[model samples]
Target: MTQSTTRTSSVPPLPPPKERRRLREAKAMTEKQVAEALGVTQTTVRSWETGRTSPQGRRREAYARLLETYAAELDEKKHAKRKRRSKNPENAATARPAPETEAASTAAPTPSRKKPLNRRPVRTVQADSRSRQNAQRRKEKAAALAGAAAAEAAKLTPAQAFDELYAYASPALVRQTYLLTGRRTLAQESVERAFHLAWHRWPEVAVDRDPAGWVRGAAYDYATSPWHRFRRAHRHPDPPNGERAGRALRKALLDLPPVYRRTLLLYDGLGLDLPETAAETEATTPAAANRLLHAREAVAERLPDLSDAHVLHERLRELTETVSAPAVASAPAVRVSSERRAKFWTRAAIAVTVLIIGATAFTVVTAPRQYEPTPAPGQRVGGVPAPMGPQKLSRQDLKLRAKLRDVPMNGPERLVPRIP
Candidate 1:
């Protein structure tokens, strides 16, 4: 008997492995289930999904068909769900409402309902009141402690005060100076100079209302002075590393004008108050406030994420900590000896006296000389006899006088003849 001949066509190309995996996951089918259906190990199916090894021959055809079927099934399920929701709108709405109400009721007890329970007992209420009063008493005790600390601080010797301030303030000043100057050595030098000044004036500085502010102001001045510029010109330092966040922040900060940069760093970066920042920058409080606002806008324009005060402050803190100078355990005292101070005053007084004497000498030498004018023949003198009414004229004098008398009167009257 002759059997009917049948032809089998080749399977089309399967979707990419990633696409296959996505389709399988969409239908919530595990690799094991797909593997069991395909009569293969789950590891084989995993390889196929991960694109490590693809199925070959008829297996490839079966895999493609499986993914397609599952994707279609997922779509059908979603469509069926939507259709049911549309057909029984009231039933679906009522079904959701009960669960939502249950959830809300459950969550409400966690916060508001439980709060009333804690508040229900009179004893608890009394305890809370007592706790608040205790907190107030603690605050008063803290204030007293602070006052005693201030008194103790006031009693510290100049050297002790200097050491304390140097330890506490040097790091912050160095960081602030670096931001202002953008040079490590220059920043260090500026801080050193500032502290030196503080050391010399510690007697006064220790008693000042805001010694830190004074030091900060001095550091700023030192950072911005012409001497620093000259030094910077002579020695050009390399920029910060490109990989660090501080590089971008430092560049943005340096782009700002000195006034705005100092105002911003002092106010936000160093945590100085508005008035203190103003004093540091030599600006009025309102002017400093305006500068801070403008500076924030300027920095935000450059680095948008660092616009918030808190964010910028944190960023600056991080950058500063990265480049801060080591704490100085001891610094040389700048206080002049009493003899030296006396000599300085003596020299100053001598200089002043010399200046006064030189000025008097100069005046006497350069002044104009006074001379008395000789009286004319018939003119009167203030302290002398009036010339005798013209002496009798000799013939020769008479002739010369007659010759001069005939000459025209060359005066204002002659130049501008009187109107007739």
Candidate 2:
């Protein structure tokens, strides 16, 4: 059917949320069953029931019709139940009081008024009620404050949020990155580049639930990016300090797989929850936990003294602190650099686009407009050559020809110019 016809098709009205659920339940149907019958997901059926979204187009019509059928079935079932009850005299009799009993109950004498039951003192009751109300008010106030804070956070502009995140996260990330890659320069460069990227993608970072984590992931990825192997500065790792424990721990970390190392850092070093670590490292929770376990075991074997997570965290912190780097790049510097980089890329893209357009236009201009059939490889004779006209015979040539014709009776010998 055409869109207009589909739009105008009368999809039957559906009951409200409660009624919808009641109808389904009365029909002894589950959301899954209904979803299967309608060729939709259980979540879709749930959304329809909860009024989050309504099915549209053919699905809507189908669902509405299905509900109607379910309602009809329920009605039939109810009618059957009513008929059965009516046919069962015992049940019907128990369903309503006899007319005589009802009259007798009404005619029965009223009992004497009893003393007022012991009641809670008004003061105590009022105090308890007041206390409960006060408690509720306090809870509501706390909730409101939390909501207000969240709203305030939400109100921040993308740049403001990004700047805030950068200011808070960049320095620590720089240090953490140093721990990840043993190079201070790479750490600074990676952190700055990561921030530049975050600034460039501020809109996404700002809306992200974990902006810090987002930035951290980027920094980690850049710090450990495989292509860095080709860079002269990254060809060899920075030498570890005199501390044997720190050296061994760094060695152990380097020995671990990239994913496992990242997981360990996120879980043990940064003290993130297993799930959060898994999310950041892009691994399953169990995998992350397993990585953390194996990493810890490896590190413990390498540096038994620093086996405890707390001690390991402290040692990592100490190791990062051991490397003294200059002050970090400011958020504004990163933001400015990001803007400059983006501007450069944008101009480059425009230039490339313009070049393409120019090339296309030139091609269009230079292109042959109309189809011209290619001539054959051989040139056409300019004019049909005058069919070999007989040249006026020279006197000698004419005499030779007449003599040959007169001697024609000599057979082949005549053509060979033999004397008669």
Tens-place lDDT digits, model 2, residues 1-420: 688776566567766544576687667777789999999998788767644356777888788899999899888988899656534544334344478855665688333112233333355557667977998999999999989978999888777777788888877788788778778789899998888888877765665556787788888989888899899988777776454646676777877777778887777777787756755665545677888888888888888897888898787667655644435777777888999999999999999999999999999999999999998798667756677777898999999889777763756755665457
CA lDDT scores, all candidates in order: 0.71, 0.75
Q: How high is each candidate's TM-score?
A: 0.47, 0.55
In candidate 1, stretches whose alpha carbon ends up further than 4 angstroms from where it belongs are 1-143, 225-238, 241-245, 284-286, 324-330, 333-420
**Clashing pairs for predicted structure model 2, backbone only:** none
How does residue 276 of candidate 2 score in lDDT? 63
The sequence of per-residue lDDT tens digits that candidate 1 reaches over residues 1-420 is 123222123344466555676677566677789999999998798667544466876788788778778777888998899666544644443344467666886777434333432134454457668977998999999999989989998798777777677778887777778778777777777777777667656665665556777777778887877654455352544466443657778888888888898888877787777855654565445789999999999989999998888999888767766755434324543233323555787899999999999999999999878877888688654877666676787999889778667878877765464788
Model 1 clashing residue pairs (backbone) = none
- lDDT (Cα) of model 1: 0.71
In terms of TM-score, the best-performing candidate is 2
